[model samples]
Target chain A: MKLQKPNDVMLQVSMRVITLFIFAFSFYLFLAGHNNPGGGFIGGLMTASAILVLYLAFDMKTITKAIPFSFTTMIGVGLLIAVATGIMSMLFGYPFLTHFFDYFLFPLFGEVELTTALFFDLGVYLVVVGAAMTIILAIAEDDK
Target chain B: MSNLVILPIIIPFIIGAVLIIFAKHHRLQRVISGFTAVGMLILTIYLAFLVYQDGNIVLEASNWPAPFGIVLVADMLATLMLLLTSIISTACLFFAFQTVSSDREKFYFYPFFFFLIVGVNGAFLTGDIFNLFVFFEVMLLSSYALIVHGGTKYQLRESFKYVIINVFASALFVVAVAWLYSVTGTLNMAHISQRVAELEQTGVINVIAILFFIVFASKGALFPLYFWLPRSYYGPPAAIAALFGGLLTKVGIYAIIRVFTLIFYHEPTFTHKGIIVTIAGFTMVLGVLGAVSQFDFKRILSYHIISQVGYMVMGLGIFTPLAVAGAVYYIVHHMIVKTALFLFAGATERITGTTDLRKMGGLIKTHPVLAWLFFISAISLAGIPPFSGFFSKFPIILAGFQEGQHVISGIALLVGLLTLFSMMKIFSYAFWGKQKHTSEQAKTPIGKLLLPIVPLVALTIILGIAAEPIFQYSLLVSEQIMDPSIYIESVLKE
Candidate 1:
């Protein structure tokens, strides 16, 4: 079934602004996961919900044209990133999932703490978004 | 090195994730999955050899010391299980290549297959209890997809029940783990064992023991909880069925053995002898009865899984060194032979386009190779001499009598006879009757299919022929596991 729909001016206009904040908040949550309660899982869900709002305000065809990525490939990339973070340790003769961290000075900012776990969390965030959207779209689908 | 212990889980985990990106490229998926399976088989064999040489290989995940972080421990028993998982999964993976439909393959069958392996290997190798639960979920989630891959009306219907039952079990698992944590204050299995030793198998511990048993028994297809095995296993395509039959329930059995031996050892008469013995007797009798009552080829084999599981747990129930060794031996034998039988069922189903015993016959005249290979598997399953099953079962029954548990041992022996009867029933109905299929159907080529299964059949025979050394190896393993202190020390010693 084609996902054609008439535009709703208010949903479209309101979501265009609201979705950006949601995306920003999700990014904050995803980054904050390392030391705080907010981490990749919830972050990914936040991002997904933001995208979901976009899909809700726009037609699926339009949404597809705007955000063009297969949900499965997103999940795959996410898993690969998360697992690779752990696997990188083994290459250095450390046990699996042995994370590493260091404080590096930035040009724009003071010293910033960098860690492999952040990448791992990023992977989790992506997977959560991919999985949630995939489930929703699968259910929301019109009969073929 | 400790790093090697982590490879089995990582290999599958990485390959599974990679396969997802190429889901639509079925040929690439097959090539990559095929190579990964063979690579895993080699890696596990080498890992097992390392463990044999030096003892337990422990990888403290994230370099955290035991009691604080996740750990993967490859002891003799775990390494043996990894070896078996690699063998059966390698066979099933190849068999699946030929048998599973392209539509199903397109739906990410190969990725889920490796993820299932990730879960299985992780479950066997993890030294942390919570991680065990995590691995169980990974395995079950993939299975839920694989089971319902075809999306046939029957598959969807049956898998709903399967998913529900397992979800409920996983919930109870967390509950059991929580209660365990509350009592022991630890999530690391070795630490839990250390803590449980101090707590003793008293009132709450015994309750938790039984609760843990229930969680695992549901997964393992034991006794009263086995109602879902036959129907749900019947719904999937045969290769998935073969994989599930060969590896999944064995994980449950492995957990039972691990938990009972390590953490719940106090008051053996209560937990091991009294409760486990009675359950084993019932599981064996009722399971074979279910098999004997079934006429469909796959259903019979599915029900047989329950009965054979009873034998594995029976060894644990007996709780002697010999008995536990027999249990270990039984597990290895069953994983190989069961896969062979299921693949045979799959092979025959492909030719006749049906699994009902009454609907298939005279394959022996047309497919002699399939006929005899299946016969070896069937008899090995029945405990016939000079086969792996006989050697494996002999020690368990012998130990049972020596322990003077005559009634349960008698039940075990009687179940073996009934198992033979059911297998022969399958044989006579499916292979020996007048020709049932048309000439073209009868002549359908199964050589490629049979090629993948050959290794499984050969392993069962090799396991039998090499029973002397293999049984000795299992005895060593049983010795290693029967005393929990060895594990606790290996994990806790910095």
Candidate 2:
């Protein structure tokens, strides 16, 4: 059986543009996650969906070149970072995952509070992206 | 000091994550995972000793005290389980080093292995009921992956059933937890126990109790729910099968013991005596009958797992301090002996190239050491005198007879005979009959495999000889478990 590819140039180009916008919005969600409803899980998922859209629009060779880092490494690093953040609390005689925050005036931005939870969120984001992408890519590759 | 309670869980999670990075380096992965397993064993032993000397240790995660946050608790029972888990995991990991294929190794097997440990240890130690469900998911997911590690046709097919059944049970688990929280307004196990004691056991609560029982019974492979065990367990390699046989179902039994003794004890007559005792009898008889009918070595062991589970539940059903102590002792004995038996079966399969009893014979002539070790474990499993099984079963049956539950006691005795009959059938057919395999095949080296089985066999013998002291310890554990006030006070103290 032959696989069908989307032949419409307009649909392909529009998907590419929409994928970029979704990627940007996902980053926005991740950045504002600590103070709002959006966080690592949803953001990472959005990022994966954007990549999926690219895969749908383009060929496997093109997308493989675009994402060079291995998914396994992403998952490993994400988990390590998350666990390390929790262990860091133990170093200060606090229980695991005890987050600390402090507010400081930035040069350009008005004020920013750096919280350990953001790093934890970042770890979750990476893991979500890595796991979802790995699964999607494997299934797609198997289908081909 | 209370922080020590979390180490068993954290160490594994960290090691598993790090192992994922070295997935391609088999030698590096083995060294790091080996070191981690031994380190965990040492830490678990120290934790058990601390609990023995100093009493329960409770750590509220992120300093959020008692009912409000996740907590890890290391009482005697929890520490004992942690110690046993580390022991079996270390043994199984070493065995896997020899047996598991290189492909499986490179596929993040070790990471999933440690992750499974994290789940088991977390389930054992968690003070909150909801976190227990979360830990169960962690364990189940890892298990689902590991069961299909090689992804053979048989593995993929059987693991589908295993996964589907467990997913259903997991959904039921969530519903049970939701109902319990709604009624008590607390997810912390210690807090819930306090609430349940105050309210006493109502009919609605009893319904919830049975619901929880059903969830755990499926996981524990009790009667009517054990249809998945024999077939699914047959697909994995021997090392993995041994680990699952030894540790997984026992977790379900541990949960049942913990919840029933601590939170749902107000109506023991209806729940424990009436329902549990009857189930215990049927589980024993049915399991042994299944074992007696199996012609394969691994399948026989699988069926025996169900039968042995019935004995432990019977001890719990009897519900005396002495009887619960016997159940505790039985768990320790069974975990060691069952893993040893499975390891022996693996060693035999390595030599004979088959698990069928009819196709294998006269192994004792060629591998006397392996055969003897298997013999010891077999007798111990069958409740023979002067072995670990006898001492464990003695108190439970004695307690049954003393309480005037003569029929259940008689059933226990009958099941013991049937268990011996099946075990002897394996011994005579596989070890003592005429040689069926070629001499070349029988000469296969099994030294590496026997290395793990020997320690477990020795432990069973030691447990039998030193039964008095161990029984005393179990008695103490039972006493602590029977009284919920002490557990609540220890966890909720301001």
Candidate 3:
């Protein structure tokens, strides 16, 4: 199905920024997700939407060249990262996925605790972005 | 310990990606994959023992503790399914080498095959329900590619419906998970079980349980939800079709058994014996009728997938240790035998160049090995004695009798008879009639193909001959599921 409306550079640029904003906001939400309201899934979808913005502005071949083979590989990497976080606790003699860590002083920031759960959430975020990109790109290419 | 729990899932992910780089070298790709599959088979056996020795082991992602982090648990059930999945995957991959056109192997087939295994193993091991949905999508996505790999018009048309229906089901799965999360506030199965037990209400829990049932039922191809299955499955090559026939829907049934028995047991009012048993009876009857009416060999086996699922669900719905044992036993036996039968269908397709029963015949005289193997699996599927199928079905039916559900027992017996009739129809039409294929078609060697089937046939025999120990183990698994307080306590820590 061809788009009925012609593309405008200004409109496309605005869509791009909106998509980028959603992606950034989603990442912020994901980082705060464990204790606050947002999560890995919502954050991942936001990242995917950013790519969607690019696809809309340009044809698929350009988008494909821009991304290269990273999306597929990143999917594997993200899943491995998620699994690695689970295995980390086993190495520490905790039961599977046992979250343990401590608060520490930082250079730019005062004090905060870093937990394994955040790492797992980040893994989830990466996988979501990669998988969503793969799907959108594959479908878009098929359309072209 | 974590190696046993996580390696099988990880190995496939690694191998699948590696295969992508070797896309230009078809022979090298096939050889490397074959080695990896053998390695996986060994890993699966070793893992099964590790689980057997250590009991259920949980791996929490990113060191996040329960109720917070995603966890993967390898219990008796998970390991058993893993073992079965590896066996079926190895067989199907070898079968694919013989059948999958050279063009496809060079394409995305090998990578997706590994991806499919990654998804299956992930689904089996996942402790979080939401993670289960994610893995389910992974598996379904891979299957969508494999089904339409050949890109024939027939395949494209059918797979389009298949993809749309599954996409809809996946969306529904997310919606159901959202509802479930809202209700329980925890995605961990063990935590959900504990919380659900505290609030024991038939009103809302029942709604959530039924919502879950809807999601799995569609995926598992139960009764009214099975329309897309036969049409779409018939389009794939025999090997891929056999793999889907054996493994895909069973994963759905596995999830249902895991969730309903463990987490959602609070409300018998909605999911209890009444609702499930009714569905089981209808699923069995309708499935067999569909099989009886089909003139094609693959189509018959596809319908029988629904029928066999009914038996497993009946065991669950009965909600007794014996019945659940029967269900567990039935799942193992069906996985092996069903894959074998489907492969045999593929073999016949290779020899005769058709899957239509009417166009096939007299394989018994020419290829007695194929005939006998089909006979073993078919008769077993029909619930014949000493063939593993009988042992699996016998307990469930006996459990029905013991539970005083004589009516269901009778219906089950009737379904068994119809199953036998349908199998015999395939035998007589496809393998027993006068030779129907032309001379050129008959020249194809059935022996090379039989290599993939020999292990499954041996397993069916071994399972039957050693039914006592296997039956006892299944009983043990059933005991754990029925009382699941232990599972809950173990995961959640009293």
Candidate 4:
């Protein structure tokens, strides 16, 4: 039976397997961004690409039903997170966006290095995802 | 060193983001936005006072040193801009709260409004040229959203043109910034000023200066490049129109003044006297002519915004302490008076359901307050004596004649007469003709609508009456800005 003829059955099955791997890789990219080439913006794009693949494999209706959240509000939440991170520095009597870092011992991870830049990066990551998804989805769903 | 400089930018940014959550909740959005506006007003007033008393207040972002990391500088000029921004924005917010439909307000209007404020204030305060571009993007982004908020066919069409023009201008702005950076080997404006002074503005520098002028002129609605302004400004809601009319072009003029004075001052004969003044003359004459031809109230006000911008740049073109001071005073006066006139246009449109002056008549009999208030503001804008416009124009024209720039000065006076003529035409057509509206249409309650505009009208009158002190304050600001060393020292100081 040639499953690759016209319908998206095989493509859909493959996307299901590929989607999980993409999510893991994107998160890895986000985490490794502290010292490497990967960062929030690129990682967020990667995640958005994975989501785009899901929308491609399935129709918009199915994918949106599975993930029922407004991308516009997601952008707002992301921006709030980002601004709050900057204001945190202000609350600590430092200048705006003045990030600080220290290493603390953990049970299994030992003395893991952590920094405020990571949180800032997280906000950027969320915003990029939200923005990218919003634009892509809006264009795809446009009736005109 | 102070952290106060970024507060204006940050507060709006935070509130803008916060307001996005409550987009559907109209009353809450208005309440929060109103409080933010008032808070910003008080903060800027205090900040302006502080900057006036103490020299410049510089904020090094994230504990970064000056000339390396980004810095926000609140000098007298920046603070004065911030003060005007807060005042205009506060009034615009209340006007929007009263006049804007809930449908449009629900479409993330308050968020973008606050973001526009963030961008304007940020543009005023940033010490780095690149940061200025970022803030410009922020401003243009929000303005794009606000312009097309209602998604009308006309709004979409006009705003598309608006967005394209601004985007092209922004691309040129980026190129100019990159070119300036490569030549000076610095992105910090003060450092660029220092390097420019070192190089003494050679031929290459003059080219870059003209390129910068073209970019900013497009944004500020200068002659030959202001084709995209009037129609686009005529599309949006009057509250948004008033805000854009009052504030947006001034940001462009502010950038022009900042760069021309600080970085490009060494070759004023080539750049300022030769190029800017020539452009300013044409901008004034052509812009006023466009106003004369327009029969729509909003269209007239929109074209007038372009003409008034020419005056501000003309002040800068003269490059004297008093002339630049006149420009500053004119910026404030034009901002207040222009916003009020736009609101009056909105008031009449609300009462009559049309902006066509030919369709509107006998507003003087019905809406007496709006008619008289608009008349006062219109005459003030026409450079009538004992109003803000006369004082602001007097110094610039005086400086022009003193500097032997009789041609451009004469052009300015002619434009002023045409301005008065067109204004009187608006008065006659809209207020003195046959009463076209039904008596019930005339009874449309504009008392509450007029509330937000009263302050601005009063400001125009007060600015006129208190021109001496206001002119002196602007003189202080102009002296601080004209002398580049003060700004350079403040920003680059360890």
By DockQ, the best candidate is: 1
Tens-digit lDDT track of model 2 for B1-494: 35678889989998998898889999999999999999999999999999899889988887887899988888898899999999999889998999898999999999999999999999999989999999999998999999988999999999999999999999999999989988999999999988887888897789889989999999999877888999899999998999999999999999999999989998989999988888888888999999999999999999999999999998998999989999999999999999988888888889998999999999999989888889999999999979999999999999999988899999999999998999999999999989888989877888878898888999999999999999999999889898877788889984
- Report residue A75 deviation for candidate 2 (angstroms): 1.1
Model 1 chain A poorest ten-residue lDDT run: A1-10
In candidate 2, stretches whose alpha carbon ends up further than 4 angstroms from where it belongs are A1-8
Over A24-115, each residue of candidate 2 has an lDDT whose tens digit, in order, gives: 99999998898888999999999989988888888889888988888878998999888888889888898877889999899999799889
Question: What lDDT does model 2 reach?
Answer: 0.91
Clashes of each: 0, 0, 6, 0
Candidate 2, residue B251: how far the Cα is off, in Å? 0.6
The local lDDT score (0 to 100) that residue A129 gets in candidate 4 is: 92
The models' CA-based lDDT, in order, is 0.93, 0.91, 0.86, 0.91
Identify the runs in model 1 with alpha carbons over 4 angstroms from their true place: A1-7
lDDT of 4 by residue, B331-351 (tens): 989989999999888889998
Residue by residue across B182-280, what tens digits does model 1's lDDT show? 998899999998888887779999999999999999999998999988999999999999999999999999999999999999888998999999999
Better by TM-score, candidate 4 or 1: 1
> Model 1 Cα displacement at A141 (Å)?
2.0
| Number of the top-ranking candidate, with lDDT as the measure | 1
Question: Relative to the unseen true structure, what is the C-alpha lDDT of residue A1 in candidate 3, on a scale of 0 to 100?
Answer: 79
